[model samples]
Each structure stands twice: as structure tokens, then as C-alpha cells.
Target: MSELTTVARPYARAAFELAVENNNIKAWSEMLSFAAEVVTNPTVEVILSSTKTAQELADLLINICDDKLDKRGQNLINLMAENGRLSVLPRVVELYADLVTEHNQEIDVIVVSAYALAKKQKEELSRSLEKRLARKVNLNCSIDKSLISGMVITAGDLVIDSTASGQLNRLSDTLQS
Candidate 1:
């Protein structure tokens, strides 16, 4: 996993720089996402991992992607194919998304609650998180009955756990200590 990420970082950074220069971050993001999906298809994965020549693999991928990828994007795919790095495309997409979020000065936050949140509640939570994180917050809400009650807010490395299960665990730890 770490090896893939290490190999993918340079490619993702190059793509990010190109996107920034072209002012086409959104387009590049969509293109990379589509390309990643294509590369991950079962047939495509088999082909990629087979004994085909680099050019053959590159052509197959480019043809599969077709009009969704621009010339530079195609070039990226070709380069990765030539280097036997096509399998790292998914990691590149993940790193690219992180770059895009940072460039846009936005952060993604996940809220796991026992039940659905009202629209008003979501808005309030977003507002509160934005104030705390000092960045525009994009909230992704999910339901987890195991939480029992309340919610867990996760913004990157910071986790604010308010769920009943979480509280009980903390109490248990205190008692144990």
C-alpha cells in the first residue's frame, strides 16, 4: 500500500500542477475519476496485469477511456502504462482529490449518527464545523445504529465522539484506570 502511494505521488502531483496551470481542476478531477474507474473494471484489470506490451496496454486503456480523457490525460495514462504503474492510478486519484480539496480550501467531514439528521440540523452542524475547522466544510452524513445515540464527527485526523457507545467506552476506561 505504501509502495503504491510512494510511486503514485509524483504522478498525482504532476497532474495537480497541470490542472492548476490550465485552470481545469474540476475537469481533471472528473477525468481522473473516470479513468480510475475504467482501470479498475474486471476485464481491464485482467488485461493490465497480463503479459501484454506497454504500448498495447496503453492503447487499450486510452481506447476504453475515449473522449473522457484529454490529450494530457491520455499521455498520463500512456506514461503510467509504459512504466507498469497503471495499477497505481487509483492511488493517484485519491491523492489528487486531497490536493483539489486543499487547493479549494475546503475539508470533507463525516458525521455518523444513529438516525438521519434534519436539514436544519445538518446545516447547523456544518456551520459549527466550518467555524471550528476554519475551512469550508463539506458534510457527509451516514447512519450507524451501533452508535446507539448521538453522532461522531470526523474531520481529517480530528474525531469528536458524542455517541453513547463512545461515552460508555470512555467511562469504562476511567473506571479501569
Candidate 2:
């Protein structure tokens, strides 16, 4: 895991647990997502990277976020800022989102293909993936001309590479061996 993820895991877990306890996962998710976006903005990033005091950093983030943050959300920002981990908010949000998806028994799947998939094809693919993974699947399709043909499906740590180029590479490796 990347250092950022390592640093973010605990914070994400805390946020996730709190959300679950409060039965406010949706609100927490929105708050984190918005905060992540704000922190990633170029202007906000410049200010965050400055040598401002921790309280100042927290105040800046809280002000920018306005009423988007609930009391708990503001506390999270204060804790992160005080610990000099404000920059890790984006990673924290990502990890927290993954936790929420898992809790909801859902998975986001990415399919990169040589061409756009038809509506029926996408539905079929989603159904197949849902059955195989035993989870609700959210399909995101994208075209990657380099695939030459076929597509690649990715979900969490799993990757299914059925592209023509991928097959050729595997076949070449076998023949060479």
C-alpha cells in the first residue's frame, strides 16, 4: 500500500464507523467527497501547503466547506489538520468510499474496451459480473483503442484482461518459454 493510504486507513475507518453509528453514511460520504474536492483545488492546495498554523488550516477548510460539514465532520477536519494530515483528506475519502461500497455489498467495475459497448452489452456484462462477484455492480465503460479488440474488466484487486493484445502477449510468453 502507498504511504498515503497507510496514513489514511485509520482515519477512513473512524469516519466509516462513525457514519455507521450515526446512520448517516450518505451525509458523511457527501461531506468527505466535497472536502476532498475542495482540498484538491489549486488555490486551496496553495493555501494548505503554506506554513499556516493548524488552527488556521482547520478554519480555512471549515469556512470553505461552509455548512456542508456537520459537527462531526468539522471535528474530523480539526483532528486531521492538527496532526498535519490535511493533505491526506483525498486518500481518506477514497478509502472511506470503498468501505461504504463494501458495507452496501456493492462494487464499482471498470471496463476498458477497443470500442463503446452497446447498452444491452453493458447490461449483460453487469449482470455477469454481479453473479460472479456476488455483489451489486456499478459498470463504468471507457474506450481504449490500444486494446485492439475485446475489453478489460477491473474490480477491486481483480483484473480480467480479455483484450486481443493481452492474449497475444500471454501466448508469446508461453511459446518463448
The best candidate in terms of lDDT: 2
- Tens-digit lDDT track of model 1 for 112-138: 999999999999999999999999999
- Each prediction's TM-score against the native? 0.93, 0.93
Query: How displaced is residue 123 in candidate 2, in Å?
Result: 1.6
Clash-forming residue pairs, model 2: none
Please write out the lDDT profile of model 2 over residues 109-169, one tens digit for every residue. 9999999999999999999999999999999899999888999999999999999999999
Candidate 2, TM-score vs. the true structure? Answer: 0.93
- For residue 90, model 1's alpha carbon misses the true position, in angstroms, by 1.9
